[model samples]
Target: MTRLVAVSGSLRRESANTTLLRAAIALAPSDIAVTLYEGVGDLPQFNPDIEHDAPPLVQAWRALLRDCDGIVVACPEYVHGVPGAFKNALDWVVGSTELAGKRVALINASGRAVHCHAALVEIITTMGWIVVDQASPVIPVAGKNYTQADMIGNPALAQPLLAALHAMAGVPAMAD
Candidate 1:
């Protein structure tokens, strides 16, 4: 099974970002195993001064990313850009070698409004990670204008996201 480390950018108890992560978890193929690293909000501010020996939490986060086959990020928009907390989390990943050449997929749960996808793509690419082009899942809120209540049950939204996950996991070949 492919081991995937998925992280949500939001730390709110009822955040749409967290809800979107849950949706991704449900979309995972049975063959791919997903392990979520919660409490992104609890991580300390990234400091270049303390780069040699990382804090326990930072170390733990890095370890997971390094070990996993791929990384999935679900994020919300802030001030027409990436969330500060989300940016900070990415900062902690700078010194780690795990991110180099890793496969990454991004999902923005912002409904209707055009997201910061372009900006985020630039940032992820600059980090030396391979962002899957065809697998982009930018869910601009469909018809109902989207709300927490509208997210959970819609198979239409879920199916495409599932396809993205399957692509990230890389489809297995048929046996001879």
Candidate 2:
């Protein structure tokens, strides 16, 4: 199975980015498995002093990133950049081989998240992740009334993410 870790940039439990990932999960192809990571907020602040004795949470987080075939992120823009917790979670793996050369699918889950998206792309690329070009489709979902149902039922919202997921799985995406 092609395992992918889907991370939401927003820390809220009912965030639009989270809904986008859930929708993607609902629309994923049979050969792909999407696992949502809910620990971004749970991760403690990043600090190098404790790298020698990494926390259990950090260990589990790194293990998942290392083992996954790909990473998908639905991020929101805060003050024209990434959220602290989301960036913190990513910071924990900067020098690790966990995400080296892993395929990445980036979805700008918010309407006003272009800057954040660009920043995220740069960060992921610098970390040795190959952000899949075809799968990095943008959909405006933040601060909207859209739900997981809208994401799954609406072709506009579902098709692009499905394409991204299929691309990550190295499979041809079907037309909706």
Candidate 3:
């Protein structure tokens, strides 16, 4: 099975980004097992000294990132940039080999989040992640425009995004 980790950058209970992630999960093919990392808000700031022992929460996130076949990040822009909480969680993995050269997809749910998504892409690329070009299909206003449960029901955006994800998984994995 292709183990995919879907990380929702928003901590809000009713956040658009989180809803977008849920919709993605709902749309995923059954053979691909999806796990959602839902605790970014609890991760402490990254510090090398503290990392020597690695807090339990940080370790858990590191393990998840390490073992996943691929990753999907649904992030919402805050003040025209990536949210601090999500960035902090990502910062903890910088020094580890866990996520180096991993496949990642970035989904920007709202039109206002383009800059933030760009910034996040830059950061993730620098971290040695191979981001799929077709993954960002412009899912403008996932929550405000559509109900949280039906975010991925939009055929226009969902078709391309799902195709991108499956394409990233490729044929051999599917044929098996």
- Winner by lDDT: 2
Determine which window of 10 residues in candidate 2 has minimal summed lDDT: 105-114
Say which prediction, candidate 1 or candidate 3, comes out ahead on lDDT.
3
Q: Mind giving the per-residue lDDT tens digits that candidate 3 earns over 1-176?
A: 77889898889888877777777778788877778998799998888888868999999989998998988888888898888999998889988765788888787778777788889889999988888766655677655756645556667666655765675576322331
Top TM-score hit: 2
For model 3, the stretches where C-alpha displacement exceeds 4 angstroms are: 142-145, 171-176
**TM values, all candidates:** 0.85, 0.95, 0.89
Q: What is the lDDT of residue 159 in candidate 1?
A: 62
List clashing residue pairs in candidate 1: 111-141, 112-141
| Candidate 2 per-residue C-alpha lDDT over 1-176 given as tens digits, one digit per residue, 9 for 90 to 100 | 89999999888878998999999998887789999999999898999998757899999999999999999998888899989999999889987864689888988776667799889989999999888888888788877868899888888888888888989989888864
Hey, what RMSD does candidate 3 come out at?
Answer: 3.0
Residues 66-123, candidate 1: write the lDDT tens digits: 9999888777766768778778888888667657998887876665434566677887
Deviation in angstroms for 116 in model 2?
0.6
**Separate clash counts for every candidate:** 2, 1, 0
List the candidate 2 regions with Cα displacement exceeding 4 Å: none
User: Candidate 1: where is the Cα deviation over 4 Å?
Assistant: 111-115, 141-152, 172-176
Descending-TM-score candidate ranking: 2, 3, 1
